[model samples]
Target chain A: MHAIVCIKQVPESPSVGIDPKTNTLIRQGIPSIINPFDLYAIEEALLLKDKSGGKVTVVTMGPPQAVDALKEALAMGCDEAIFLCDKGFAGSDTWATSYALAKAIQSKAADYDVIFCGKQAIDGDTAQVGPGVARRLGIPQLTYVCKVREVDLEAKKIVVERLLEAGKEVVESRLPALVTVVKDINKPRFRTLIGIRKASQAQIPMLKPSDIGCEEEHTGLAGSPTEVVKIFTPEPRKGGQVIEGEPEEACETLVQKLMDAKIL
Target chain B: MAAAGTAAVRAVAVRAAGPRSRLKQRTKRYRLPNLRLDEENCTGCGACVDTCPFGALVLEGAVVRILDSCTDCGACVGSCPSEALILERPKAAGPAVDLSAYKDVWIVVEYDRKGVSHVALELLGKGRELADRLGCRLAALVLGESVSHLTDELFAHGADLAYVVEHAALKKYRTDPYVETAAQLIRKHKPEVVLLGATTTGRDFAGALAAEIDTGLTADCTGLEIDAASRNLVQTRPAFGGNIMAQIVCKRHRPQMSTVRPKVMELPKRRDGHKGQVVKEEVALDDEKFLTKVLEFVKEEGSTVNLADANVIVSGGRGLQDPANFKVIEELAKVLGGAVGASRAAVDAGWIAYPHQVGQTGKTVRPKLYIACGISGAIQHLAGMQTSDIIVAVNKDPDAPIFKVATFGVVADLFQAVPLLTEKLRKRLGK
Candidate 1:
């Protein structure tokens, strides 16, 4: 029942503003948190670990500052945490990112039975990396998974209900498979005092490309098949009229104007 | 016998390449029939050849011969007069190609009950732009039962060519068969780019199809540009909760793919006499190839809050307090002849179903008039509706963030303001 979960660190946004004049994101003081969707993935993994009486290991690939995210996951009850952070990994798209992750899993936790990932990272929302990893590893993929029905460790099989466009479909896949879980799966547990203390003092071993057998040609933007060419802001519309008057008078004016326009 | 094609259409998805016997490969398998081309009932009318977008089947002498290019899309199965075309699910492999051979830009024309979809029409307008810039031909692949008549509309919409595929297996939108048909067309014709609508159905299977063909697909793109020097499509979309925009390109992949959200692009003007080539293609069908079946399609039940398609949307938040209070919101919507929408907070509070929620995790809506009442402007909510043409925010708090994006702002308690507005509109409209 051992599970390996992949999580990513994302900016706490929807509040973070962008500078219209500079055409840049305002991230100077905004804090970062684990991707909300990945939290569900972690929870499902921990739940499986509990049921089978085995350990759960979490992995992440990002810049050096990503260690904070790994520490947070450890604090949530993962037994082991590994971070893959190197300058070469910068600017990697979903393809290269999945390559680095799959390589790390192969090097670090090759004996694992099930590998879990969030359905998508809210930041990118491609939902490509999970399937990409499965293809590269030559394994089966079950995506948009909502519930875990059964886990037959001895039979090397697991059954789950995957959410599709219409509804849920029950699917069974041989173990040593990859699953991208959706938020409907489970609610994550908060860090406890004992778990917090253990995580705060834990030493997370950071690995580089060569350490995990990832080639330089397949680890960064150079290895990525996709490229970002240009970026511009979406045009904003003209502001509407905000009527000024007493609440009742303003309401009357709105109705009168709409009627004159034959709208209401 | 057809040459072993680079891709197989709707065959068993599992690869039995690892020395597993055909018998051993069976799982909780479907007992239904596989894709079979029954020769006894052959009419040799060559209709199947015209219906196969992949150019996989041909009428030679008097018999229909499947080519090596067959991707196994079952467009030909149901069109045969004597039921000559049949299918049987088999262990399969993916299409392998020399990337240089691919050309042109193709759009998968999707339709709803109301004929061709708005998203598909929008893509045609955008596709014409890209095709012109790249100096390549623009094409549309329309698939369905008895849908060839739409070719004239496709041509008028600016598709230089239309590939019409028809089959009984395609009467309904099924992921397995649709992707099989689409992937096989890519493998055989080798289109440089493919566009699809970023609707619920598009998002459901777009990634899986990309995986099947071993290609990259960018989802929900708001902007697309051709990189002149590289002849590549630069796909751009909002990232990190709309804080930043990321422009992505499939640098090495042969056919770059993207799913554009509906209403993001303008539709092409209809030209009454526009003409183009229409190639009819065919696909085989089998019950085993389909992973799931659609029991019944329930029309979007009660409230007409199809936020995505609505021109005017009045959304409420948790400030409404109780489910009963939604009546005021509905009243306002009814008077305006628009739809009633709610924020995630309202949906989470059990005031409404999730279909009415407007936020990042919810549906992205870009209506002409978006009125937010009793809703605190959260970034998540704004991300979904910020693109609306006219935004109006009403809240008791004067500094609520919703006002930032609103074209009109009102600082008043919704209880006093909303009902008054609704009453005035109802009286003024004689409703």
Candidate 2:
């Protein structure tokens, strides 16, 4: 069994502030870390590897600095790392990004049994790429998965539980499928000393558009179908009247206001 | 077609349906975009000249001349009183496909034994408006086993047509069968726009469906509008948290798809006698072709996880000080028969479970009433609940940002204020 995990390096803080004057993201001092949700994906892959005795490979598409994320995944017991970095990949939206990742997987790791991705990235919060990649790969997708119930290699199938708004559903899909895991799946493990030492000396392989045999027209901002026409800071909510009297007085004022507003 | 070397026209920006200032335009300044001059309509009003942020438009001999510096931001297009300035998109977006084949607006409706979901009806309401504006029919795509009864409710809400496809395999949504059948229907019918709720099922199904159909899809859009000039769907959504709002458009793609967050749109009033057309359709499906299967379902014992649909939510934050103080919030929620929510800080401190957390990393809720106790409003937290109809904040700090969005704020100790507030509500409502 071979497990493939896709991860992203996002801003350390989920909350980003915009520069009102320039109308751009203020990304100067903020650090980058593994996306919070991707941690679960990486951990889930390693857990699958531990149970079935297979290798786990981590993949990411970003700038050169994204190698740090792959290295961190290596420190978490992943066997190999693939860095998808290139100028042509710049400004790729979910569609182009997923296309590039799918191309790389087809070229580099086509023999994998299952692919794992975090439910959604915090910065974009789109949750589209996992299913997008699955669609492009012509594979089955099980998203918002909270638990991996079983891996029946003999049956060539994987069973998992998906957490939905209404309830949880236990779903079974064939091998070579894609699963996007939520944070409730498991608590991610910390990097080990031995694993960190091995990661520091590991040579991460980098894949470019040419290596993946991707078309330049279909790999970047130009290839994206949906374009962000305008970006602006949302209007700030106006401060309301505040009552600062004793607890009883404030409570009475608040309740009366709710009653008058017919919210009660 | 717009020329390649020099500035070329992509698409024109006709007159706005609303005010110019209200419509925000795009940020990419890469390609040189040129506006077509309707010389006959030019009145030399000089509005386009002043509206150009980069001085790219100049009033030359009574007609505005677009300079080489123009990036086609469309700022000047709206300023022309005679509607003479028409901005066209750069041809780099790829060869323009004929969009005439696409018509009507459709929303995929989700339902269960309990009946249709509220978000589906909300989409119908918004879909009705968009369709009316575009002068097209509003339709609903209903998929599941034995869901024909939902057509009546759908029509009563807003849908003019209901496309029902039933199969036992579709009783539970698996990406493979659901996307396959929906794609088939969409390919044959070619609707101009498709809307879905950004629920777990909708998000899961939409991405795969859009990808399979080779179209663009926007997620959790807060605003959907029709571009008068291009007849495109302009989707506006909060990008990350709530700081930057981006308006997206699928100019070249047919069947423009977008998923809106539940409760974000207004739910239309249901008229029981309202009726519409119901078309029963069948598609080829073999059980052997499906690679996925549903094994079992486990419904959450309590209603604690229903934050998205909750009418009232009482959320606690670090202001609660200790985990035990969560009891006060729970007590209030019980009295109001609402759900209990917590801030990331409280959830991180192990005061409550992760499902109860509300914010950017948590749940984005649009409840009728929200009571924030001890929660100093973080931007992320505000992003989640600021849309609530009525907000009441109880915090010790008078300057907390939570007060900014609160409809009514109390700057007293939450421990003292919350119990009193809860007690008063209980007595007044006779609960």
Candidate 3:
């Protein structure tokens, strides 16, 4: 069995201010890290590998600097890492980006049994790319998976539990399917000294659009269907009504205010 | 047909429609983008000057300068002939969906054996206004087992029509069955806009359904509006982890869809005896098609796991430091008779389960009284509970941002301040 995990590098600090004039984000001086949610995806893949004897392969698409994320995944015991870096892929939205990734998987890593992704990237917060890639690949997608129940290699199927509003559901999918994992699944393991040594010496392979059999038209902004027109902070409510005084006086005033609003 | 070097865009079945589409000569005010042309890449061509729709560009010697009327549509970027003109944004997002065929505004309804969720009602309240602005019908699309009875309830919240797709497979929410059923309804009716609550079920199903239908969807929107001239749905939401709000639009798509967080919209006043149309449809998805089965439901009947519906929630943060510090929070919640919640930091520290956490990754709540102890207001944390009726923050740091939104703030340590507040509340409420 071979497990393929797709990850992304996102801003370490998500609290970014927008340029009031241009209505665009000011991304200067922000550090980058592998998306927080993708850590859970990596851990889930590694656990699946440990449980059922398989190799884990990690994949990420970003600027050349994103190779660090691949190295981090390798330190966590992934067998191999692939970095997808291309200038044409810039400005790709979730829809077009998923198309590029699915094409990459189909052409380069065609020998995978399962594909894993974070439920959503914290920066984009779309959660659409996983299912979007599944659709582009014509495969079944089981998302928001919190637990892996059973892996029946003999039956060429796997069962997992998904988190719902008030309950959980046990779902079974065929082999060579995609699953988006949630954070509640597992705790990631820390890197060992030997693993760190191997990761430091590892040379991650790079893949471009031409290497992945992707078309220029479907790779970037041309294929995207939606666009962000403006960005702004919400208007401030009539704030600054803080009751000034000692703790006791403030507590008494709060209680009185609560009573006036009929909340008591 | 696209030009030789420029990228091509897909054309859909859109033609202007409805009452407002005829108002083509609309006046508007918009911020112009500053586009600086690179002299190194300039080819001394006049093509861009002719292609500028806003008349904001001119070629001077080898440098091209943009005037103030540049709307950043990037139309001239592709026609520049030379690679001199550039903007920070990407190429034109090219998919033109037909506006003539799609009409009504539709909201998806979620319910259990008990009844519908309040978020569903809240969507209808907003959906009514969007439909009215578009001069179209406001409809609620419900798919489940034995859910036809919900049609009348939708009418009370301002739905002009109820579209029901009933199937036994939909008795519980499963991704495959729900998306397939919803796709059938959407393809048949071709609603112009679709809305849903950003609940667990909605978030779980909306993305897949949008992908399946090949439509663009914005998640967790706090604002929705109709662009009068274009009749496009403008969806706004907190992005960049709630630090900045972004307005997104699928201008070329037929069904502009978005999932909004609960409590962001006002609940409409219920009008008794309001009549609306009810239509039922059948979706034939076999049980075998469902890749997953619901084995068992673990409901938080007596636990504090489900904080979304709590009338009052007392949440603690990493300021508590250790697992033992949660006793103070639990004690305070016990005194107030409210549910207990935690920030993502505390939950990640192994002090509490993920279910009891509130933030962008956890549950969103709109309790009447929300007390934050030792919680500095991260935008992600505030996104979940900022809508609470009355927020009381207890933190030792006077500069903590939590006090900015708190109705009442106590600038003291939680370990000492919480017990004092609890005792006073206990005495007043006779706990």
Candidate 4:
């Protein structure tokens, strides 16, 4: 089985600056890293590759510099990497993003049997893209997966544990399915020297809208329906009053405060 | 038809130009196509009609047509059957909101059989501050059966006005009717900021309402403030497994919307005999229009100690070891009349349920006093309780990160410390 892992790069800090004119993230000088959650997805894919003897492909959509993130994923044991980069793809919302990704997946449909993604990107915690991509591709998607229980290669079926609000449910789906993984899935392995050497020389395939048969209109800001008209940070919380007293006295005082607040 | 076809052919020709002509020739190719409608796949369910707030969709000759002045907000996409309708970006941008039209801040007072949820009142408290800062009025949108009786209560709790939407159809929580009623009320009186509780019902309702209004909404927010510079609602929530806190803003949309989790803010002090204008509005609702039926409402039986609402929480950690050993922590919690919480380690070990876990993956809490028993705080764990008013750490390791945030740090084994603490509290309380 061949697996593809979708990853994204996001700002490392919460202090992301937005361009007032465009209402878009100002990424000119901001430091970015592979979305932390996607790391677990890459790790899980590599683990599956190790057990089943399959090739893993890491794909990411961002500015040209995002190729570095794809290279990093390759160093962690992915066999190949792809970058969906173009100026037209800028300012795409989750809906348009998933459309572009789904088109890219269709371009490589013959090779891949399973697609893996982090439950949600850190910068945009909508958790909608993976499911959206699955919907666009007309494939079954199991989100918030915590563990992979079994894989029947001959039967072309995979069983995994899905994380629900109360507990986990064991779900079985066919091959060519999409699974969005959470952090508890697995601990990612560190890159070895051999893997680093291979990644340094690896040539990442850059795919554009023409290569994927996607209309240029559906790939970028032009295709995005939702818009971020404004961006701002939340106000700082008011500092709480510190109660200084002995343990017994403080406990009594706290209880009285709760009662006064009618919260007790 | 000829002119439209010629435009499409020209678009194709321009797009066919190579990457080298990246700057100039692409200008004409930037225009987006009309929203695609697959007539064969359309089920004519009228979902897009009801869901479209801007009146963008209309059925003509058994087919839906996109109107010329559509905003392309994508609200109709979720409601489409056979996935026939798709949102296509317009060649020209939609009209942007003129912020001067919006004025006061509003908080939706969400009451049920259990009375008003804490987050509503918390938002009211927060809204009061923002309204004061912006020199605007703070109003509460109260909707329920005979809810006008609670208008005085809403005014007492800091609401300058109570916009009541009372109806028999709203007696129980249902999605379609409630969203329609609330959205209509919002359209009638456009408040600059609208807040709701992050409870199950609130999340469901807020998502639909925001989608209907074609606005932005930040969910499960821990903080809210008015940007002194832009007068925008700055909503903050935990993201990425609570690794970092993200502050979001809906600048262009009116009624900057957000949902605050319970116990994240302080409830406002009530002023007795406070009076405010109660505007009663009737939402058009018929018996046949209600699609989803509520067969019955079954209340779960339990001790009824909602940890999310608990002000004082006594949480245990892995050092407690076994499921049976958790009884000591519970005893101590019971003695103090507080809810019992647990670290993710304990929850994963099956010593307690996941709801009791306090961490990034678990619930974000800001209780008045959080007692950490044997929790060697990891960053994930700290993300949940770091905002507590008073933290007391009890663990054998003196260097635990919990000590950094704890008001009083006791370096003692939880096995010894917890039982002793429980006995002391029990004796002190004469229990």
Task: List DockQ for all candidates.
Answer: 0.09, 0.26, 0.27, 0.04
Q: Runs in model 2 with CA error above 4 Å?
A: A17-27, B1-97, B321-324
Regarding TM-score, does 2 or 3 come out ahead?
A: 2
Score each candidate by Cα lDDT.
0.70, 0.79, 0.74, 0.66
- Record all residue pairs in model 4 with backbone atoms less than 3 Å apart, i.e. clashing: none
lDDT for each residue of candidate 3 in B1-431, tens digit (9 for 90 to 100): 00000010101112211111212212232222435677788887766664442234656686676643343435466666677877664445544556689999999998877787889999999999999999999999998888988888899889999998888898877777888888988998899999988876787678778777877788889899999998989988765556556677887777988998887798999998999999988778888866666666766565455576667889999899999999899888888788899999999899987878787767668788999999998867886777788898988889888888888887877887788788888988898
Best-to-worst ranking by lDDT: 2, 3, 1, 4
lDDT of 4 by residue, B1-431 (tens): 00000001111122211121222312222223245678998877766664432334667778886543233334456668678976544463443466688888888887755666667778888889989988999998887777777777788888899888878888766555676788898888888888888764565466556655656667677778877998887777664334334556665568777777777777899898877788888788884655433433333223323466676889999888788988888887787777788898988787886556776555567778788888997766776777777777777776777776676566677787667766665665678
Flag regions of model 4 displaced more than 4 Å. A1-264, B1-95, B144-146, B166-177, B220-223, B227-229, B236-248, B284-305
**What would the per-residue lDDT of candidate 2 be over residues B275-302, giving only the tens digit for each residue?**
9999999988776899998998998767
RMSD of 1: 18.8
Better of 2 and 4 by TM-score: 2
Please give the TM-score that candidate 4 achieves against the real structure. Answer: 0.58
Judging by lDDT, tell me the better candidate of 3 and 4. 3
Runs off by more than 4 Å, candidate 3: A16-27, A165-167, A192-210, A235-246, A261-264, B1-85, B88-95, B301-303, B319-325, B334-337, B360-368, B378-389, B399-401, B426-431
Please say which candidate is ahead in DockQ: 1 or 2. Answer: 2
Q: State which docking tier applies to candidate 1.
A: incorrect
Error of 3 at A56 (Å): 1.4
Model 1, position B130, has a per-residue lDDT of: 95
